[model samples]
Target: MDNNRLATKPHYQILDGLRGVAAIIVVFFHLAEPLASNHLDNIVNHGYLAVDFFFLLSGYVIGYAYDDRWHTFTVAGFLRRRFERLQPLVVLGMTLGAIGFYFTDSTIWPLIHTVPLWKLLVVLLIGYTVLPVPLSMDIRGWQEMHPLNSVAWSLFFEYIANILYAIGIRKLSTKALACFVVLAAAVLLHFAVTNANGDVTGGWTLNFEHMRVGITRTIFPFFAGLLLCRVTKPVYIKHAFLWCSLLVAVVLFMPRIGGATHLWANGLYESFCIIIVFPLIVYIGAGGVVHSKTESKICTFFGKLSYPLYITHYVLVYFYVAWISNHNGITLKQAWPYALLTLAGTIVLAYASLKLFDEPVRAWLRKKLK
Candidate 1:
């Protein structure tokens, strides 16, 4: 019966492949630290935009997977599924980070206290919804803003979006129109806040401290994704111009828009993401770019492991670099080897988590809950 049920379900391999792509981009973006020094920061800095891609993708996938079930959106079921999907790997990552911190020097005990037993207890019990502080002490140093459980920050909004969906907010209209309105409001709010703040200096105020602000900015993009699920037009005709126009806008306007520009930039950027970038992703998925029998095997493997890869890669990168710096004279020029090492280690760890942790727990949850 379970096998039959699984067979009947829609399998969006393209979305899985997209997850693989997003995870890889994030890893490479961090890799830039070891590879590019001040000379190439601008070129590589843009890779952070991959997070936006993940956000957009999440919006689409959630909508695609659950739109028909909008009437069934229930708080208990929503939280249960979300908690099952997200918590295993998150807890694993946090636990690993806490253990790593505990084993470090005693002089750093106060900092370790930041992620101490009590905090771990809180995270395990309450699911770590509180804001995370930066992980490293040296604010001016290379990994200044690093946090132990940094990647989980985005999951906060992901969960919020899910909660909103589950609570029957999505049944107000056709999913597409609902998404359009929400996205529009987010963009407008972002612009209003930015202008009111007198055109601030950094990228959109989209980091951890301003999480609520970030969630507001992203809601529209996510809903835009939901709309994509209902899109039936041919991708080439539907999205090509959108992509071209947005690409042109980003290239032409991003530089001139100037410092602390996440507000204006995110609004335009998300528009492009929704109208242009996301469609391209869907096109790639629909095109069977990774759907050959051999490719399917590879994609399935990576797809299954992608979540852990996304969560753990950054933590590994930070710790690997820290350990390396403590032992030897490593420089940015020597980043390739370290990057490769980090990738290899992360992949191994991710695979282990998938097999030993994620899959088992997920199966257990399904059986016990269902």
Candidate 2:
């Protein structure tokens, strides 16, 4: 096989950069989570919304790259491709999390000392496959399948989306896809408004309610992105990348709207953001052209870094969160220096993994799989 013939499809470079931007914000948002009494008051309040944006991006990219290729692409081939691209970082993230686990002992996860080494290793092995562990096997008190690495839950739903696409959704006509999107959107609305917290958060743990939250979050944006790809006619825009990036930042950083008295207000806002705002951002990003070499390079770097950074940064967060616990709830002002260090350290670690491990391993797999 000619390696050149197997080159990846061209991406929306600005969208890639925006993905990295959101990933970075998510890191900061996690840092701020310990500070707020609840979701309504948290600084960087809507940071969790980044995952929805990511799902939208994933759908657009997947549909753009592979929808037409299905004439020759098998389910097995698609699954293998996704696994090869994603699994390397998953392994590295779990390994890093495991290495840092003992260091994260604190009040939040008090059972860490009693968790057997064998059980941790078992979770690590399962994490490599992105499989959710049963609650009985949850070594950590949090009931997360990947106890050492909590973020893998989204990756689990990501794989589910890919599997659905490969098996059936990819074959749907544009009209059918639109219908699916509408249905998903309605479910998302229902999930958001009816929740006690009145937001789209809390899908990390493995349970019936959380599973509904996870599926609702996954379906709407993913299908809506695919629908947008099918229907979109690109429009030229000035400074689209900047504008779209700003839109994302503002949406994520906006102070929580509609407090306890008006929970429905926040729910409507989140629903609107996911079903409407995010896809618009992706549309602008896709249609907008890169105007300079520097912008192109930045997008390239971000595209390369986004997944690695998202997957690996939470390991550092575990330590940071534990440090907060050990200090008896340190304020953000007191924690700024260490928080800055963790932020810098995560970027360095992500870059190292991308260059020294992720790229090399992925390249080798592509060759062998070719």
Candidate 3:
């Protein structure tokens, strides 16, 4: 085998930057989440949409990275790559949550200290696999798949997408994939337009409804991204990163539409963005090249920072939210300083996690497994 062909390829640098940008927005979303009186009013209201954005990016990048390598690859090997890439951070995020759990005791989760250590450890270890724990494992009272780290729900869906791609979906003809993507898109539109909330802002809690939301949110972008990679050639779009970043920010940061009365308004808006807008952004991002050294460095840094930030940032938010609940009626003005600290802390922790933990561990795994 030609070793170079089997080796990993260079990333689409701009997409990496886009991923980082979306990840950062997700953090802001979570921080703002506790502040929202309800899901409708959260200033970073559409921040949850970034998860779907991440799926699009993942689909594009995975298609770019692996579609042509199957001759030399196996399903097991592909899964190994994904596990090494994702699971380490899963463990770290869970650990951080466990470490901070008791200390964050407040009205938000007043029973935090009451949970037995054994149950917490059980959830933590199961979380290492990124599997969704059942309601019986609801140590934190939120009933999330991984209460220690709620974001793992997305990662669980991410693994499903990857497995689907590896086992069968990636084998389909381009025409077939397109048909698949269209069906998936219909699922997404139906859910987004008519769901009870009028927005596609959930999937964290494991339930039939959330599962439908989760599966719908995941498949369309991912398969559409794969189809995009297969059918289109990336074209040069000047200022691609800037344009894409702005589009993402505007979409995610916009206020909920039609208020409580016009849920379909918000639903249709979100559907339009995810179905049409996000894929367009990815296509543009993939096409653009970095022209300046400074911009190149910025993209590289954000690319490295994105996953770790997304995976681990919520550990601190658990406490931030608890602090808010403890202090009744805390406004953003009063909480801004602490919120800044939470943001800064997550950034620092993500950097540390990337360099100090994730990279080294993945390197060692590759060496051993290979």
Candidate 4:
């Protein structure tokens, strides 16, 4: 949910920068993923929680930007603005996935070769809409709606939240909104505590459980974020940006608690982090200010890069994961060069796409569609 809220209102620059920090850590999390056998041992263990933070951020920003504008913000207008802001990078992510798909062929995904060219194109076309496809259409073994760009699943849920907001949630009284949030939280708690994995992960696949995971992940934090925006009384905090950024990093990097025997331990931890800690971070970020010229530039640069980096970088990750699979037993030390290359390549590609494709296309869409 690296959305275009800045277009509607003055951004909390610190929040923008903190988002970029989380996105970068997600890259590191994905990098470390290929090295781990399971979630517990993974370095950057809680990085998946970043998606929850993102949903919260999106809700808060959307509420801040649009809550008062309901008098003027039609459903069609809201959807159009959201589609323009989010869909371009989605299409680009899918395109990169397709472009890199063949190069990623390996024992881990040998079916990549068997997939008919027509089916690949078909999946790519479906992916452009950012809608979930059934397992029958899954060309890759992963059964993702956008198999080319697996991350598009979250964007799919993001659209759902937006649609709900535009149609109904925006009109609800604060008390009613609180009730809705409570219901969503119950669902989230049930999902987290009962989940077999001992954590709030697995929302990427095209299955019932995964769909539930996606929805559970989306609704609570999003509504909570909206609630926070509605009820929060601002208080200034010194060094808020740095403090919030460190909090995010620490939460993301913390080692997985509880062994297999105590799965609920980790589940409770994940739920508590999402339900409580992320909101505090967002509150702190929203009340923060740039303290100097250097800090201003830093926030501006990261704010610009956050969305592009999140959307584009995973394509390179697919390549890296494939390479690792093909070279069995390749240690991080042995693969450091390729890992560094993946990181640098994602950053470079993201900057280029922002300048060349995203900004131009958005400008054109705003001219014609808006």
| Residue 19 alpha-carbon offset, candidate 2, angstroms | 0.6
Tens digits of lDDT, candidate 4, 38-80: 7788878999899999999999998888888766647888898
Predicted structure 3: lDDT: 0.90
For model 2, residues 1-370, the per-residue Cα lDDT tens digits are 3332455788889989999999999999988887777677889999999999999999999889877777665788889889888999999999999898888888988788888899888888988888888888787788886887889899999999999988999889999899889999999998888888889986777799788889899988987888899899778898988999999999999888888888888888999999999999999999899999999999889889999999999999998888887888578899989989999988999999999999999989988886
TM per prediction: 0.73, 0.97, 0.98, 0.96
- Best-fitting candidate, scored by lDDT: 3
Candidate 2 local Cα displacement, residue 278, angstroms: 0.2
RMSD of each: 6.2, 1.4, 1.3, 2.6
Clashing pairs in 4: none
Q: What are the per-residue Cα lDDT tens digits for candidate 3 across 1-370?
A: 4322386788899999999999999999999989889988898999999999999889989999989988887898889889889988998999998898878878767568789999899988999888889888888888788999889899999999999999999999999999999989988888888888898877887788888888989999998899999999999999888898899999999988899998999999999999999999998999999989998998999999999999999999988998899888889899899999999999999999999999999888778777
lDDT for 34 in candidate 1 is 42
**Candidate 4 runs further than 4 Å off:** 1-7
Cα miss at 142, model 4 (Å)? 1.5
Q: Rank the candidates by TM-score, best first.
A: 3, 2, 4, 1
The Cα local distance difference test for each model comes to 0.56, 0.89, 0.90, 0.88
